[model samples]
Target: MSSDLGRAMPIERPDPLALLEQQEAQRLPWLLPLRHSRMAENPFAFFRGAAVVMASDLARQPHSGLMVQLCGDAHLLNFGFYGSPERQLLFDINDFDETHPGPFEWDLQRLAASMVLAARSLGLSEKQQSRVARRTVCAYGKAMAEFAAMSLMLMWSAQLPMKDLIDQRPSANLRSYLAKVTAAAQSHDSRQAVRKLCEPDASGTLRFRHQPPLIWRLDQLDEIWLGGLDWHTWMQESYQTYLADMSPNMQHLLSEFVCTDTAIKVVGVGSVGTHCPILLFRGKHPDDMLVLQGKGAELSVLAQYVDLPVPEHQGQRVVQGQRLLQRASDIFLGWYTNPKGQHLYVRQFHDWKASVDVGKIDADGLRDYGILCGWTLAHAHARSGDRRAIAAHIDEPEVFARGVLEQALELAELAEQDHALLLRGIASGRISST
Candidate 1:
């Protein structure tokens, strides 16, 4: 670790509300209220949406100088269980919207800070929050050491299955909770999405159900929202481009399915107000359905701060970063430039995607969850960066833990201050919130 590993960054902090407003300007105008409201829900929620704020703060700090493909917004909620292409329920960092090559410590710091904020949101004691935060960092260091000792092949092939993770838990209650989460996740396939989000239209063709402000059919939206783009032509050209970017085998499999419908589907705290669309496809049989989501991607938040090559297409950056970091990626993952010239990544939607609600878990469960996330993050970093160098720098897990926890605690406090500022902005009508 550097002499100033956990030392606070010496830089002037920007006004949180101003930074937020500037960022919001680039997003959809009407959905700004929803984004503000979601972020104002709590400090944890605020922290989740304020990745840009943290990126600014971290930019001024001294780092280990060891670069890795970072999950730029590595909050706890971003680490979850999702179905692999092989149909296994694997636990890993699931979001890569902000992923880019940067110092390995940036990801660790973000995760550590999230653990503290998440624990605080759950009403856990300060002692408990400290323990959870430290445990997360310590587990990350320990995992990196273990990865360092493993052969490259073994380390690259490692994966954490939900079943295996559940079996390893010592507490029956925790195991039971994990088991329930696993079962629920397994049920979140295309069939489940169709039941919940789709319905038969007057023509007896399956189409997405209209849920205004969240999900809206193409015809239901105004011309301004569509920005004069021809929905049919856009979908046709976009799907062709997406298919061209996919593997030949996956493209062959997709050739069997024809896109039937598409709807604007707003999702996620940070991602709200972005141009995200959900597509419904039908195969040879009416019952055979597939749902895919296209999320607009921009340059990573870390790109401005780090001296790395900027990707020409933001969506390609996300797909490539995800492929390098995840143990097993979704086969349908691909990128395309939208009609508006915005880059968007496409992937299977809600295919056994599951996340633990940190706000609902007890202190013990939070600690366990943090450890799992920590180890998973280490595995991701090990795959994309130098495990041996990171392990050597981490040398002593306890020391590294203390340093990261110190920085995380400070960051958690900074987030609280920012959250309070957001509340004040809403109260004064300076920031809009629904």
Candidate 2:
């Protein structure tokens, strides 16, 4: 925004080998599997293996604007609704640890690519897929304009609360699934989790009960991944930043409720292989306690595209971005640098955490939900800075929707192309398998 970044920013992308050398943040094993996926390529195993190459190409794209913030491996799956500091239910782009101020198109490109891939997976025809893409882009266009008209307070206040997002929808299929998820989520309270997961059975010692796709004890992951004193130290730093960001009352409440000194297993898709440890802080009663998750933060992928001078410490980036982007942020959100020199971003793991399941929704449902996510993401982008100009640039959803459909088609091809290249590299032994 401060500069015509399209021309000003460097387009020199980082080399794959060089990017992989950075610390925990640089290694993304999840991308490897996708590159090797045969659906995209077979000579070397296509989708299972191409993350580095895709990022490399993405980093080289021309800059769009600088109102951008970090977008961690943003894909269709990553966009979801969560409760904001305020109780009002509205949706927005949720992940930000790897956020950066680079080409706005970078986010768009990634989002479009993911949407096409998702639609393809759903067995939609090419034309049908493009329609889905068009609708999402159109939604984004309107949402951006809508956001440009709002005040910071209003933008911050809106949240697509789990209940509101799921409950408001008219579909019975979604309602049933959401109801089940909600029940499971609410029932698995800290007290309940502690009573079940943390409390050992015959052994009689408190330990994490393995909850598939959700909760796992620390010992489950490989040693190299979760290993080190660095994790513990980072948790402390993350908590300190959390303290600085919180109101006195909430800070004191968190301090009393959280144990603040232990590590637990945590999991996420893009973050599958990283070291994410949960820190428990028990307060007045276990029921009144909170769960602070210190997930690992990595270098912004945008770094490949723009010079985007940022905090050298990834933990600081996460904590800083959360404070800047979200008005009603988690009271315990924080970051710290550990003795082992690792960085961790700390926050309450679940403050009514919920997300829309677009994959399961019917074509019509996905269309509407896609629009909602686009709108919410635009609103978020607007809140981060002056969005009136961006809004003016694309007022109606029509042109942008067409542009998005075109871009999605192009990006999908690009993904397939890069995935093929990755297979070649892997076969030649230039890349490593997970």
Candidate 3:
């Protein structure tokens, strides 16, 4: 631990089931929405809007052992938005707060449960839900098999680009939508992003303005970064390593716009309590801009099973994982040890992105999207783990896909039941909340 951070932030470990019991009453409110979600059925959505019990339930769960690289909290809604470095607007896994290496099953389970949840939302018949889920798992299984067989070099440069994504399905509406999303994505880099997200102060200096409740600029943190001992070292020492790791062109470009910027809390469901900060900077030209995000890195939800070292710095796990998982990672992708010795992983915030809404998709679209996510996730996982063993284990995608969907149905039910318990716990005040 850094001398600056006197005591490490003790890792939080909560009893997921008991926490649910305590949060149950509070969750009774969103039971209905959860039920109608695409994952499972029979939830009571009486007072449908609530995040309290949901947050506590996820916060309390025991870690899963299955992360050979995993997207922490792989629920459906967590995926969405942003542009890619190529200036293409594409969709893929966006959140990585709980990312860690353990058992790969954890990521699969979370993803399946999310699908079931979305299906429930559509009020699909049990059979319909099953079909949608089956399609998704099958796609995932198939994709994993394909990924496991690739050559090392191919795996490294591999990308499920938007063209390949839209081409898999050759219909007219999708074709049109693909062109639209593609065009929009190409024009959505950080410069345009800054224009859309920033505003001028009365003094004419550019500032990010919050539109009432949704968006807010966080320049206040400048004091914390400037005056704090940890921040001083991080800005001076860590910044070099961060810049060194960027791609050549990105490095040169970032050289111009890499000035200090403010950070802000953005959005996510499972990651509500986590630190997700965005850095805003202006380059040589007023229009030259970049946005980097510093998201909190914690022990993987898979920590319970893995033989990890005593948590020296939580951010190390993430820094290595992102390096391992993505082919062309952000130039500033690195970890920082804070004054309080907190570990944080940094990346380009609002880097191009997109995700298909599994919940809103028709049964066919749901199946296709699931296959894509499975394929993409498998490629990521295979790169991080023992590819030989994983490939051997999942040689057959079609059969394994079916089994995953079946298992997901069961897991989805459990998630719903647990969610119910959480609502009760919260309503009874067994779990404290503000």
Q: All candidates' TM-scores?
A: 0.96, 0.76, 0.73
Q: Tens-digit lDDT track for model 1 on 331-423?
A: 889999876688999988987999997755678888988889999999999999999999999999999999999999989999999999999
Query: Candidate 1, which segments miss by more than 4 Å at Cα?
Result: 1-10
- Number of clashing residue pairs, candidate 3: 54
Instruction: Point out where model 2 deviates above 4 Å.
Output: 1-55, 70-72, 84-90, 150-189, 192-196, 201-203, 209-247, 258-261, 264-266, 284-286, 417-434
lDDT string for model 3 (1-434, tens) is 23231223235634554433333332223222322231112342311112223333332334333337766556655454455455444465666655665556656656666666677766767887777666666666666666667788887667767677677664444445555655665565667667877777778866666652234344434455334544435454545555654569766767677555454454443333345556677777766777776665655544443444434566666666655765555555667754444567777665655445444456555545555666666777878776667656656766666766766776667567655655565467653333
Q: What is each predicted model's overall lDDT from 0 to 1?
A: 0.88, 0.58, 0.55
lDDT of residue 82 for candidate 2: 45
lDDT of 1 at 35: 91
Clashes of 1: 0
Sort every candidate by TM-score, greatest first: 1, 2, 3
Cα miss at 325, model 3 (Å)?
2.1
Strongest candidate by TM-score: 1
The candidate maximizing lDDT is: 1
By lDDT rank, best first, the candidates go 1, 2, 3
